[model samples]
Target chain A: MGGSEHDDGRNGKTPSAVVGDVDDFWAQALVDVPRETYVLRLYVVGNSPRSRGAIRNVRKLCDEHLAGRFDLEVHDLNQEPWLARDAQIVAAPTLVRERPLPVQRIIGSLSDIERVLVGLGVSPNPAVDP
Target chain B: MDTYESKTPVGETITKSTNVLQKVPTGIKGFDEITVGGLPRGRTTLVCGSAGAGKTLFALEFLVRGATEHGEPGVFIAFEETAVELTQSVASLGFDLDGLVASKKLAIDYVHVERSEILETGDYDLNGLFVRLEYAIASVGAKRVVIDSLETLFSALGNEGILRSEFRRLFRWLKDRGVTAIITGERGDGTLTRHGIEEYVSDCVILLEQRVHERFATRYLRVVKYRGTMHGTNEYPFLIHAGGISVVPVTSLGLTHIASDERMSTGVPRLDAMLGGKGIFRGSSVLISGTPGTGKSSLAAHAVQSACRRGERCLYFAFEESQGQFVRNMRSIGVDLKPWLDQGRLQFHASRPTLFGLEMHLANIHRLVEAFDPSVVVIDPVTNFEMVATNAEVRAMLMRLVDFLKSRGITAVFTSLTAGSGALEETDVGISSLMDTWLLVQFLEGSGERNRGLYVLKSRGMSHSNQVREFHLGSHGIDLLDVYVGPAGVLTGSARQTQEAKERADAIARQQEMDRKQRDLARKRAQIEAQILALRAEFEAEEQEVMAILEQDKRRELVLGRDREQMARLRQADPNKQQNGGGAG
Candidate 1:
């Protein structure tokens, strides 16, 4: 896929997990058993520095752990504009998790790790990590 | 289906078969559930209450509910509150009065009545009110009319007699015209409406009150009298929230609570065990009655927090304490309702009883119950509510409410303040008969070291252990200890030896007792006085008749004298029966 994070997210325990954007599903990321699994397709326009950072950071974490726990497919919005249409991406960098229920999308640069983790398919940190 | 039903002639049904059909639904949440349908098709219902007891809201909501929910056009005629104020206040309640008014589905008329503003009897016959009402109603082709309140114009008129006649005329006119009207009135002491609006509007009269006792302000509603329909006579607790006025008429006492066979903790194992099977059934009414400072509220709060911890909705209606103080106080007991409130599962309806009357208290409770739909409800010290209702009647109300709630599957928790030192238990204006579980949080004063105790006095239809468990109010919350009951009941007083022995026990205790006694005495006195007044009225009528009789006797005597003079003239003419006694007879 286009340099996205994990592939075998269906089994969970992915390090570079992409959580959904909905606030209520935050705790779902930390659970041992996976309830909701999504086939996330991320859209980035022309591989900008922000896009490159997201791809590198996300892939690095997944390889160190999950490897095949989740599936992340990235598409360049400018190159395959038609793919963006399928995911209903209005902006350059968008995350569309298309499975489970209620197809969700998040339009942001995905800099905040907690946001990224919560937005993709990952659980929240159990403790505050004092 | 009652008194007037049999007596009054079956009036011609106004809804003709050919009339276009549409139902007007009053989306008062639970109220609609209670009414089965809504306010009678086209009959008027007088929603009377004291100032600021949410009379206007009740009427406006009826209008808004009719307009939006069921597509029934509505007209709101304001007498006291400005349109802007009504909109602003109701908007906080999540109701957009302006939008409804603008949609042309609703019409609002702000009627400003000034006594000085040239109101003459010859020209004015409530016609101004009628004109404005008609205009608004016509603009929307309204099926509902709410004059909130109708009495403002009457209040402005110094000539009270004229106001009474005008009220009769206005309501009659409305009835004839066929518009379901809700006329708001200011509640006086006795009558449903001030200025004796009760005599005329006997069909349906709903009384609302806002009482402030111990600095807590709450509202209640009661159907003082409903003519046609059979409704729960008990005053329903209501709440004025961000939505609108909500009335809770939980009048079904459970003779049929399914013993869940479920055991829940009282937060303290000992106390829980004492409450039989280690806990009370879900949706049961747990009453904690005790003298002041017996950790009643804390115990109730403990239950609430426990319920919340289990992720169930919990609501606490505190009559004595503020939300913060309640939270902080319960913090000692380790019970927190704040989290659930944040999650929209817990709600605290705190206000003073004196802020309204018994009806307002009932209405406030009703409103809160509807809005919260709490799995568990706690009224910390319903003694304030006792102040508003008659002991026997209050019990009846409670019984009905208990039954009502049990049917809906909700647990209720109440803390009753037992006044007086020798009080075996503070009898709540007769609400004991209605309680499902009675927990006595007594204060024992033996051995010079006063201590508090918690005991399960009684639990109806359920087995409970009869043991006194010790408890104390500390920084954390109410702590329950298994200190063997030394015979003396729960005690509360000084733990530390003081120097001067001053502070002669604050006015809180004495004042409440004094108030209770004073209220009793005053009620008795008023009853006696009313009886005496009635007798006096009868005697006055008789005396007036006697005086008239004496006057009649005097007039009779005068007539007799004239008769005697005519007889004398007849005798004078008897000379040959001179010209045939023409003057004799």
Candidate 2:
């Protein structure tokens, strides 16, 4: 996967909280790690822009890096309306890696390959040349 | 902190036969490893970390790994994430939280901390948390419990002091009900935990931090404090991965070195021949010093693999890679980590060196050694430890680790990073000072071919190769030469004398090998003696059983005699004794 999304960009994504030291799990995830294998499911409302974009971005990542290694299942809350209440998919485009172990759920774009991978059991890779 | 001191078993029948008091194992992999066996059956370990340090992941791992791996169900209490969100996040980590929920082995209770609502004027026990947690743990017969980001309560409550006291009571309550809990708190700089959770949880505190150095980010996990037991203080590097968080605490190697005479090979015949023709002494600590990219870790890994092939349990603590990554990379250099790991003969304890305090590393090493019972241990680079400890402290810690290894009769091999003209002897930060045999690796200046070299600076009670050998990593592994050192001083760190240095290394390795053999022989002798003692004990046990039986029989005979004599006297005293006796006859 291109490092674009994983790169802690110079935008509003820069944590609004002025923290000299990061304390959130996402910050720790930026130092992405190696892959273990993951099964993710994205909960979306419909073919809405936000849900569609999240799906597209995440699928690109899986195809690029995870490829055959993962099983990503998308659940459209709009289609199965009851799932929103049953599984309580409060946030749309919420992706979940449900297999291997230590299951993880990302509320937003499974977009950041690094965050998604780190959450999925793939550790951040060290530069080979180093 | 277990504080098991007060609750020692008092009165019980010694001869009883029962195994009903079995306890469940903690779900975290290395957590249990460092904890010797596992956490005490019914207690609490407060994992307080800064936000997003994987506190929730940790809690989930405890519950999921416990329920899945160790067969102990768990309850995960998330105050921020909704249960669905929590499930989704964990699903990305490869945890089937929903499936776990389905099977009833794991439960997720998202306690929405609505800051906008409510007044607690009365004595409101966090009975809600207790009820939910209790229900979750019991539904699947959970043996573990975790409250992710418990500090949220503090944030919502707006009373620090009350929260602190309440926490203490809550933990005590959990313990009484026999639940091994992991309560997570947010970290505030200079504070052990958010909302002053440390006041109540001085027992076991793990601090995880995300550090960005040179635009590169790393997560560190450190056991800041464990009240009763020793834990590594180093900030163990961790990765947020599909499996949640993988913590790598490099060899917390202590000064525990066991003196052994058994000859062990470095997979280099010449080198072995140089060490007195036997091999590196079994359980002997060897320090390999080198600059970056000098094949230090590769060479060490080769030696470790060699020992592992011989049925010795080898632990390779990589400060850089996860076990999976380490193996994958090593495979390119012809090192097969799978078989060893599969057989449980070789265990990898790979963590970033910066993740822990120097002492924490020592404790982690001790803990792993205890759990794995490895015969051979290897640390990739001891020099990195300088970043964590003072020089004196490093020396003392190494000495202690060496001593501990010695007591356990474990052979240790460590690589130390260096940047100098010669061997690591001149570099105080290197572990050469504490090593029995120092193998020097460096880049040969003139040749410019990334030359791999080796030499033995010293060997205690043994003669080893003095030559620096030219070797390279290949498909089979690193192969050493039987060559001599160059005329240029070994300190010069030049490649012009590569051929000569190779010879010297060979000779040194041979000498070290021979010396190692002698030590190994002695070790064998000692082991034999121990075995004899063990056998003797076994014999004594049988003897005691026989004796107990014989003594019991003798007592029984004496009682029979007393009864018989009394009966005779009674017979004689009876007036109709003679008539009765004659009739009976």
TM-score of each: 0.48, 0.46
Per-residue lDDT of B254-310 in model 1, one digit per residue for the tens? 377665556566666567767766688776778888888877887887787778778
Residue-by-residue lDDT tens digits, candidate 2, B155-217: 565545655655766776666666778888877778867567777664577777776543345
Worst 10 residues of 2 chain B by lDDT: B1-10
Error of 2 at B426 (Å): 0.9
Residue B28's lDDT in candidate 1: 77
Chain A TM-scores for all candidates read 0.60, 0.60
Error of 2 at A74 (Å): 39
Error of 1 at B308 (Å): 5.4
Best by DockQ: 1
Best-performing candidate as measured by TM-score: 1
- Residues A48-122 of candidate 1: C-alpha lDDT, one tens digit per residue: 665565566555433432344446687765456445434434333555656533455544455555555555545
List per-prediction Cα lDDT, in the order shown: 0.66, 0.66
